[model samples]
Target: MITVSNLTKRYGSVHALGPVDLEIPRGGVTALIGPNGAGKSTMLTIIGRLLSGDSGRVEVGDLDVVTADSRELAKKLAILRQENHFVARLTVRQLVGLGRFPHSRGRMRPDDVEAVDLALEFLDLTPLQDRFLDELSGGQRQRAYVAMVLAQQTDYVLLDEPLNNLDMRHAVTMMRQLRRAADELGRTVVVVVHDVNFAAAYADLVVAMVDGRIAHVGPAREVITPYVLTEVFGTPVDVIEHRDRPVAVYYH
Candidate 1:
């Protein structure tokens, strides 16, 4: 389980995030949703150890995120941030290999190569693995970055706006893959999504954030209701039931 306690981030006089506490269980997909400046990205980045929290603690399983050795933490958790800047010229394969650095210490073993291959296959990037990152389409590049994170083969996965730039088909495929990863592989999956309907459809749990704090956290059904969603997003959202699931409708 991932435990967060009184986490906070501040920038000058602005409190960007937290004074928040949350518990994420093992082996399920959880989606975090919120409006602009809601601190969703800040919390996700802090949990992933990509950004430092001004105060408070985050522990993934037993590893203390604040002080744990980063190399060791890489073995326990893998994260994909919202912004990825790869100015250096590198092939998709080489970039994916970097995920194995923690386990292989920069010298990839055969198993590590196999892991890279599997991740490429998982993201349907085996065909583009030889291509330079800058040469791929936006969605393809996003898949490649996600594949790199998956190749790390950690127990916990945190993704920030992973569906960005993905077509409908790819986004559906990615969510299904994440579900399978949770159910079949027993990995914990946490994703930040702008589309509440996607979170409604794919996540076992929905964590709604607003104005630097958690507005709601519960099973998908409980949080996806019109009342809760409308309350969280501060807009009237119509809820429609389809195929035994609740889908939020915000468009007029």
Candidate 2:
């Protein structure tokens, strides 16, 4: 399990995040949903060790995120930030191959190759493996980035705003693929998503944040209710059932 205790981040006197505690279980999809600047991204980045938090501890399994070795942490957890910038032009296959660096250290063995191939297949990017990242659409590029993270084969994966550039169909496909990654591959997936409906449909748990604090955390059916959502989003939300799942209707 991923555990957090009294985590906090500050800029001067302003609290960007924290004094927060959360525990994400070992093998399911957890979606963090909230308004802009609600600390979802801040918390995810801190957990992934890309950003440091002031005054608390974050543990992925038994390893302290603040103190773990970089290489060892890479093997234990893989994260894909919302904005990815690459100076060198790389093909889809080459990018995915980078995930194996923790194990192969730039010298890919058969197992690493197999892992890359499987990740490409999982993301439906096998056909585009040879294509340059610039050649693909935004959604396709997002998938490629996700494939790279998946290829790492880590026990925990944290994605920040993974649906940023995806269209409706691709967004659904992305959520389904994430769900599969958790169910079939037995990985713990934590994603920051703006769309509560998608979270309700795919996430095993929904963590609602407001102003740097987690307002609610529970199963989708329990947390996605109109009262909770409306309170979290600061807007009226109507709940409806579809496919035996609760979907929020906030856009009027």
Candidate 3:
């Protein structure tokens, strides 16, 4: 489990994130939902040890994310940031192979190759394996990045807006892949998502963050209501039951 205690951050005077406590369990999909600038990325980045917090403690399983060795943490937790930029051109297979660095240490063994192939297959990128990142469309590139994180074979996976460049079909496919990673592979998946209906459909738990604090944390049914949506987003929302899932609708 990922345990967070009194996590807080500030940008000079502005309070960017909490003194908030949260527990992210293993083997399930927990969707972090909130408006822009809601600090979802902040929490994820801090947990990944890519950024420092003003004050707080974060532990992934038994390892303190802050104190764990960089290579060790990379082996245990894989994070895919929202914005992905490729400086040096790399083929799809090369980028996915990089995920094995924590385990392979730049020496690609047979096991590493197998893992890379699995990740590419998982993201349905086998056909694009030899294609350069710059040659793929946005959604295809996004899938390639996700495959890279998956190849890390970590127990904890943190994805910031995994659906960013995906279209309707790809969005659904990406969420389903995440769901399988949790249910079948026994990996914990934490994602920050903007689409309320997608969160309602795919996530086991929905965490609502607003104004740098956790407004609500519960099952999707409870957090995906019209009242919670309106309260957190300050916009009128209508939620209706559809095939046993809550669907949010909004119209001006």
Candidate 4:
């Protein structure tokens, strides 16, 4: 399990996040959802050890995030930020191969090559593996990036807004791919999503945050109600059941 205890962060006088505690069980997909500045990204970054908490402890499995060795942590968890920029132009295969660096240390053995190939195939990027990143459409590029993280072969994967700029079809496809990753690959995926409906449909657990604290955490059916969503987002919301799953409808 990923555990957070009394975590807090600050910037000058502004309290950005915390004194919050959360537990994310291993396996399945857990989504962090909330309004802007609700601290979803802040908490995720802290758990990934990309950002430090002012006080408190975070543990992924038995490894202490703050005190664990960098290489060891990388093997246990992989995180993709909102914006990824590569200075040197890289092929899709090359970007995915980078995930093997933690294990290969810049040397590509047969096993590492096999792993990269599997990730490429898993994301349906094998056909475009030789294409440069800039040559692909936005959705395809996003898939390549995700394939890179999957190639890392970690038990835990954290993504910040993987659906950021995609069209409706691409967004649905991305969510479906993530769902497949959790079900087929046995990965524990944690994502920060803006759309509550997406979280309801794809996430096994929905963690809703308000201000800098978590407002609710539970299965999608329990947390995606009009009362809870309206409270967390400060907007009127109506939830309707579609194909046995609750979907939030906020646009009137």
Candidate 5:
């Protein structure tokens, strides 16, 4: 389980996050949904140890995120941020190999190779593994980056807006893959999604944030209602049953 206590962040005088407490359980997919500037990214980055909280504590399982060793934390959690900038020219395979650095210490062994191959296969990039990252399309590169994170083989995965650059088909594929990871591999999956319908469809739990705080956290059926969606987004949303699942429709 991930325990966050009184976590807060600030920029100058602006309060970005904080005084927030949450408990994310293990072995299921949880989706964080909210409006822009709702601090969804801030919270995910802090939990993944990509960003520091001004005042708070984060514990992934038994490891203290604020004080744990970098390698140890990497072994326990793998994260994919929204922005990725690769300076050096590297092939897809080389980039995925970096995920094994914590385990292999820069020298990849047979198991590391197998992990990379499996991740590539999982993301349907095995045939393109030899291709340079710059040579791939935007969506392909995004998938490659996610594949790198998955190759880490950690128990906890946090993804911030991973659906960016993905088409509808690939987006669904990604969510299904995440669901499978949680159900089959017993991994904890937390994702930030802009589409409420996707969250309602795949997530076992839905965490709704607004104005830098959690507005609601519950099962998809509970949080995806019209009342909650209208409140969280500050807009009118109609909930309709589609194939036995609640789907939020905002477009008139």
Candidate 6:
């Protein structure tokens, strides 16, 4: 499980995040949803240990996120930020192999190679394994980045806006893959997603943030309603049952 106690971040006098307390259970997908500048990414980056909070503590399972050894923590949690920039010209396989650095230390062992291959296959990037990242489409490159995170084989995975640049079909595929990782591999998946419908369909829990605070957190059916959606997004939203799931219709 992941626990946050009074987590807060500030940019000088501006409150970017909160003195928010949250508990995320183990072995399921939790979707963090909110409008722009709502601090969804801030909270995820803090939990993933990529960003620091002014006050509060975060623990991933038994490891203290703030104090845990960097190499050791890398083995426990893997994070994919919203923007990915590759400085070196690298192929899909090479990028995914970077995930094994904690274990392999830049020397690729047989097990590391196997792990990378498995992740590539999982993301259906095996066919493009030799291709350079710049050669792939935006959606394809996003898949490659996700594949790298999966190759880490960590118990906890945190992704920010993973559906960015993806078409509807690829977006659904990515969500399903994350769902499988949680259901079959017993990994804890926390993703920052904008679409309420996708969260409703795939996530076990939905966390809504507003003005750097967690507005609501509950099951999809409970959290993605018209009233909650309207309040969180500051727009009129209609929830309709589709295939027994709540789908948000918020178009103007």
Across residues 20-127, which tens digit of lDDT does each residue of candidate 1 receive?
999999889999998988998899989999889998999998999879999899999999987898589989999999989899999888999999999899888999
lDDT of each: 0.91, 0.95, 0.93, 0.95, 0.92, 0.94
How many residue pairs clash per model? 0, 0, 0, 1, 0, 0
The window of 10 residues in a row where model 2 has the poorest summed lDDT is: 10-19
Per-candidate RMSD, Å: 1.2, 0.8, 0.9, 0.7, 1.0, 0.9
Local error of candidate 3 at 116, Å?
Answer: 0.6
Q: In model 3, where do residues sit more than 4 Å from their true spots?
A: none
Residues 1-252, model 3: lDDT tens digits: 999999999989988999889998888999999988889999999998888999989999899988988889898999989888749999999999999999999999999999999999988999999999999998889999989999999999999999986899989999999999889878899999999888999999899999889999999999999899999999999998999999999875
Question: lDDT (0-100) at residue 84 of candidate 2?
Answer: 96
The per-residue C-alpha lDDT of model 4 at residue 247 equals 90
Worst ten in a row by lDDT for model 5: 177-186
Which 10-residue span in candidate 3 carries the lowest summed lDDT?
78-87
Q: Which ten residues in a row have the lowest lDDT in candidate 6?
A: 82-91
lDDT of 5 at 48: 92
Better of 1 and 3 by TM-score: 3
Tens digits of per-residue lDDT, candidate 2, 195-220, equal 89999999998999999999999999
- lDDT string for model 6 (133-174, tens) is 999999889999999898998999999999987899999999
Q: Give the TM-score of candidate 3.
A: 0.98
lDDT of 2 at 178: 96
Model 6 stretches with alpha carbons more than 4 Å out: none
Q: Show where candidate 4 strays beyond 4 Å.
A: none
Clashes of 4: 1
Q: Each prediction's TM-score against the native? A: 0.96, 0.98, 0.98, 0.99, 0.97, 0.98
Question: Model 4, 66-111: lDDT tens per residue?
Answer: 9999899899899999899867799999999999999999999999
**Candidate closer to the true structure by TM-score (higher is better), 1 or 2:** 2
